[model samples]
Target: MSRRILVIDDEPGIRQALGQLLEYEGFEVKTASGGAEGISLYDSYRPQLVFLDVKMAGLDGLEVLKRLRQADPTATVVMISGHATIQTAVEATQLGAYDILEKPLDTDRVLVLLRNAFENRLLSEENARLRETIESRYEIVGRSFGIRALLERIDKVAATPARVLITGENGTGKELVARAIHRGSPRAKKPFVEVNCAAIPSELIESELFGHMKGSFTGAIADRPGRFEQADGGTLFLDEIGDMSASAQAKVLRVLQDGVVTRIGGSKPVQVDVRVLAATNKNLEDEIAAGRFREDLYYRLNVVPITVPALRERREDIPLLIVHFLQQLAARDGLPARGISEDALRRLQELEWQGNVRELRNTVERLVILASHATIGAPDVERLVGRRSAESPGLGGLLDIATFEEFKQAAERAYLLAKLRTFDWNVSETARALDMPRSNLYKKIERYALQRETVE
Candidate 1:
């Protein structure tokens, strides 16, 4: 598609000539005789670029430019004037006009100016879009005390190159915190690499961390750089660090101590400058006691510990998070944005978010996509949250009447049932979706005396 350009001038000859010239250059051009008509055309056409004559009959060019900026701050408007004065040009520039062109216009200069303006407009838009994406990606939109405190801590730590250890339960936005730290740090312009320690196999862990030379192992057909080398001069996030093998922990400690890495089957130890950020759900002290994690590595990585508060701990943020997610989902899917009722939001705040912020986001997305009503109400939240009515024989009612042990059993049963329903009663799907081993799910089903007939 051709780029659109709006041409505004009082003189018919100048408008016709410029319009013709722009059209010849493969631009879709529109012309207006005066400032009022130009503003109207600008709003209607939404042109990417505009050329406005300064000395007009009724409304002058500076007023038009100001109004244009009010309508679209990113709009690119070039001012053309036959009686060009320094004062007039400075005023136009101050009013956000893209450029000033003195008239008895040089057609060549006009074309060059137009091209520069167009390219600049494109670059500005692209940069704005990128910033928007980054903001959305790391947005922790909430007003709770816990969230505010967390943001304050982020502001403080982001200025330093400290080795940060983020401790949080699974699905509590630990990685998001890590990314925010990297983006805010001095080395934000450099790479931010991540390695999931729990996902890599024990045998390949060394190669994954420190790289491997060609023919070093069964899979090493070529030399490759690892996470530490990839994250040189930047920050490397090691997730689920407690699950890493003891041997890998020892190697990581060595790298931290020496600030260098030696790849498998490589003769030289390559020096690297990397800031380490590690995260885990397990207690590192307990792991050390069990001889599964290295104490030296733990101390090295724990230079600055940031514990992400669980969702339940910050219940006040639930409503804010819900609103943020709803707006995000609606924008992404091109659907009309909806709101949750105050009562519904309060109910959500009362619930225990075992899966934390991640779980809450998924719940909001599900509701936005699947809810029948435009405004989410308490009943809708209850249904989506898998909460049964107190009158029913499920956990909701059992909690009120049953003893502590009985309530615990009932709650466990209810949670399992909810997972089963979420996965359409496919045992494998339910187990995987719950991040539990299939055999364990089966054992729980048997121990709870869950009837196959009931599940079906």
Candidate 2:
């Protein structure tokens, strides 16, 4: 399809010339005589680009430009005039004109500008799609009271600048809550920098939070800005903050009090404006009782305490969460799409998800990949999913099988191994549990070379 160009000029000659040029250049062209007609034509024609003359009889081009922008914020209009002053050009741009072209516009410049404009629009549209996808991916998917209460808390605290302390188990989506707060806050457009305190070694954690000058340590080859400085005018998320060293905790306390940070091995205090949000699975009060976490820092960050409910607490939402994970897996990961039987879903909900939502999502992905049929049955769930999925690979590690026979063999071996471990390697109990003859169970175990392990 060709690009659409609308030429709006009171001068008949100018209109005819530009219209002819655009049409010759393979653009679908339309010409309007005045501002009112141009605005009216825009409603029907809906051109992608417009050339509007500045000086006109009743309503001027600037007035039309303003009206067009008000009607459609994405309208791309270029102002054209033979005697446009600097003020007129600046004013046109201020009103969201794509570009201001002098009268007797250069044909080459017009073509290049259109090319760049369309490319930029394509990128903007793509960015909008990615943002929508991300927002949907991280959306809180539940209608249970716990989730509703959590959402209410998020809405109340999101708009404020008060420090928030998010408490939840390892996979209960603490980061998601933090991101939700940042997205709703006034600093949504700014960068969100996160540092996992537990992941970094304690000896270097202070430098990681405050930065370090060159030659400050063995690996310090250059000066680097830390998480606080990087998050200036934005949000700083300290994940697993209870694991922070005592020195780093004191420094964080000082920065929270003074709004300033001094680099390690450098005494210059640099100011920063950052909203601190922290998350941890550990109980800070217990840490304080043990003399590990500072009480002062605990009070500072605990201004607005939010505890994310575990998956077991919201069992009613398991079905919705399963559906969401299935769709997300198919869309985002390009995994094969599959459905779950009602009984299978019930069985999943019956199990204790010690790892919470993260574990559920992983199990869904595993089923999508490993299940034999398009709709997974309760037997498949029972065979593939183990009590402690965090420890055992089970069917999740069966992807390397070459063919159907190999896949069957690998799955059977895993299932038998899990059963044997569950029965503590008792052949009679394992055979009874499997509902198979003792001789067959022994032969299968011997053939597969199953061994007893202390734990999964």
> How does each model score on TM-score?
0.63, 0.80
**lDDT tens readout by residue for model 2, 1-456:** 338889999999998888888888788999999999999999999988899999999999999999999999989898998998999989999999999988788889988888887787777778988998898888988987668878888888999999999987789999999999999999999989999999999998988889999998899999998999999999999999999999899999999999999998898999999999999987687689899999999999988888787786688999999999988988888999889899999888877786889999999999999999999888888889955332343334345435786568657866886688788789999999889999999888755545343221
Q: How accurate is candidate 2 locally (lDDT)?
A: 0.87
Clashing pairs in 2: none
Best by lDDT: 2
Native RMSD of candidate 1 (Å): 14.1
Question: Candidate 1, residues 1-456: lDDT per residue as tens digits?
Answer: 239999999999999989889989889999999999999999889999889999899999899999999999988898998898999988998989888888788989988987787788778878988878767967876776556667777778888978888887678889999999988998988899999999999888889999999998887999999899999999999999988988888899999999999999998999999999999987677678888888889889988777776675567788888888888888765766888899888887777666788888888888777777899888888887875334542333444533686467557865885677677669999998889999999988754434332211
Give the best candidate by TM-score.
2
User: What lDDT score is found at residue 26 in candidate 1?
Assistant: 89
